[model samples]
Target: MSSKTLISVVGPTAIGKTRLAIILAKHFKTEIVSADSRQFFKEMHIGTAVPSAEELKAVPHHFIQHKSIFEPYSVGDFEKEAIAQIEKLFQNNDYVVMVGGSGLYVDAVVNGLDEFPQIDSKLRDSLNQKLEKEGLECLQEELLVLDPKYYHLVDIHNPHRVIRALEVCLTAKKPYSSFLNQKRKKRNFNSFYVGIQADREVIYERINQRVDIMIEAGLLDEAKKLYPHKNLNALQTVGYKELLEYFDKNFTLDFAISEIKKNTRRFAKRQLTWLRKNKNILWVDFNTEPKVILEKITNQLKTNPHA
Candidate 1:
């Protein structure tokens, strides 16, 4: 068994992963490494729903607001950087906490990223141009036709994912699903997954309320500030994209707010779907108190120290 263990806190958005991660880190006297993709971009703080100033002070965190929207980052880059960071942290502490709702990012750290054959740079550029010309719907449709299984599992609304799948199909002469199903590389440290779950209605309610709070905290202004860069991949997230439509006069404020809530609820559903497929996860219901949750982890850790 490895001496160092990684504790991952995963769940749908608004299920309190951040709060639970902080509590776990404090108990274990360790730091946190955020796996949230959106939170990596410094310009997207408000729309990304990053942890508050108090939360940051509670425990040191890595990978939060460390990148620019213009920078190109891949899961392979994240795997290298996050594993290096975790190794550095493990030199000081045996256990470290990682928290996020992004399945791809979390999977990258735990399972290692998949290796894809390199395509010509010109081919990639051509695909990107076609995406901009014909819109994401065209790319999404092609991805669905090439890799239905990945289409079902991936974030369909995510243009990057669609483009990536199309890239695999065009370059490899095989469906992207074929490569995705290949064996995942192993990791050095033991990973203990702690998942938080709630009833659908309850989870949806929390997502809706969180969106309302984000609006109250000036999400509109934040989106407006980035309106000029709405075409950037970083700004394609839920909170910003909807508000961008509002700026384009495509929708009223009320309509935009409703769409944010609706899309967030859908996102939560997708998160649950992704998490449930992982059998290694040990799930705890949200109805349990935080102290109770901590006790459960503590007891489990005592029995299985290497977990």
Candidate 2:
């Protein structure tokens, strides 16, 4: 490998990214910089499948459980911090591994993020009033009208996404689509993009089983502890938000669990869709034997040693 090569392993949740990243890091004798957004919060453990204790012991990790739930973290923040961390790691390690399921976070590290304009507090207050008075559905509709393209790509159920899109569209009198043209910013180091893939049935089965495991591991209790903060924009995630509905008596535990699996499946599909658009990704099907997959990556690294 060239000096300070960066390897990224990205995929849908439960596609074995954690295990594969650990193995790759061990093989390269390097450490990991996590791009998983949820795994960054110290209070959120079970819900976010953070590397198990043993895996963390096996390979050094950065950015895991490094923040409080209340902290205001953004993809831009992650981009800046992760780049700085990777620069430091490059001083010692040749190959730095980045692993996560969050497509936006990974993109932030690999490709520099856009420079969004400063938030207008008045516009935000008006949007917040609309959210409280007419509900997120109103903001969702507005976003769809203003930028149908982004509306289709964004998490439709996320109120924050809806509000932000509306804020830009209303204030700028333009589609949010204009700002998301995906211009690739230059990076200091070469990056090899690795993605994990599996059969759809296998992936869905794993997602369901993983949800069951999360519930058994006290995901409900964790949700209960953070129930008061559920309204926070950061807490509007798949596992916790579904459980918040259960706590509100809007759904049973069984139904909430079902919703979690369903939402996660849709999320996985979206993740794959996002990754497929990037031509740089080298896909490794997890269904194949580990030896075979490792050989593929090893061969690629040998052929293109610069990355």
Candidate 3:
């Protein structure tokens, strides 16, 4: 590993991670690499809570709104791109910032993905076929039967995730979760993790307010424009998916908004569950000042230097 550090700021949605990351980037005079999966799409802006224009102009940012909804992007793809971007950034700076609430994408950059045996294309096609015909809930049920552990952990609402796990389970003749938490790849730079946290109630309320703000900012109109391609994997996001249901006449507008809040809270809970497993994270309260957090980070790095 080199003397460079990747300062990864992680927390649940609406937890002020972006603000903290910007502060760190400004302090270190480095760029930011975003790991927020939904924020990658150019079409998703308001609902994804993308940084405001002023904030984007504050520091150089990579990977945000860099992909189209029509394009297919995966965690593996992001991992490669992000590591490369950080490498480029580290040539001039000692520290780089990576910030997002997407746990899998963040972990992909920091620890590398767990290896799994490749399943046959035919098996995957069959699984997708099952999904289209049987609906997401059917495959979700089967996954619960095949690998209850992954079923509980994965976003069961996502068809891609559901089919991926099912194919793995069938081919490996074992639970998909069994393939996870394996050995990780080494990186060239040191990683220093920081997390923002708050009481569950406070976090939930913040999410609710954020969703309302999105709605006020014309998220419903944005979702309506994308409704024609609601089945696209990129559209399977928390804010857009609920509105898609409304457009499909399966949900009322009010109920859809409520579901967005409910689903976002669930996503935040899952994020916390994933982040808590990492013991190296320097956690701070959501209300904590950025300078205070920076002091804590400096103190830790004194003992655990990036070099």
CA displacement after TM-score superposition, residue 186 of candidate 2 (Å): 2.2
Candidate 2, residues 42-110, lDDT tens digits: the string is 988888888889999999999999999899998888999999999998888878999998888988888
- TM-score-better candidate, 2 vs 3: 3
TM-score of each: 0.95, 0.94, 0.97
Any runs in candidate 1 off by more than 4 Å, and if so which?
303-307
- TM-score for candidate 2: 0.94
| Local accuracy of candidate 1 as per-residue lDDT tens digits, 209-267 | 89889999999998898899988988887888889999999999999999988888888
Evaluate candidate 2 by giving its C-alpha RMSD to the native, one decimal: 1.8
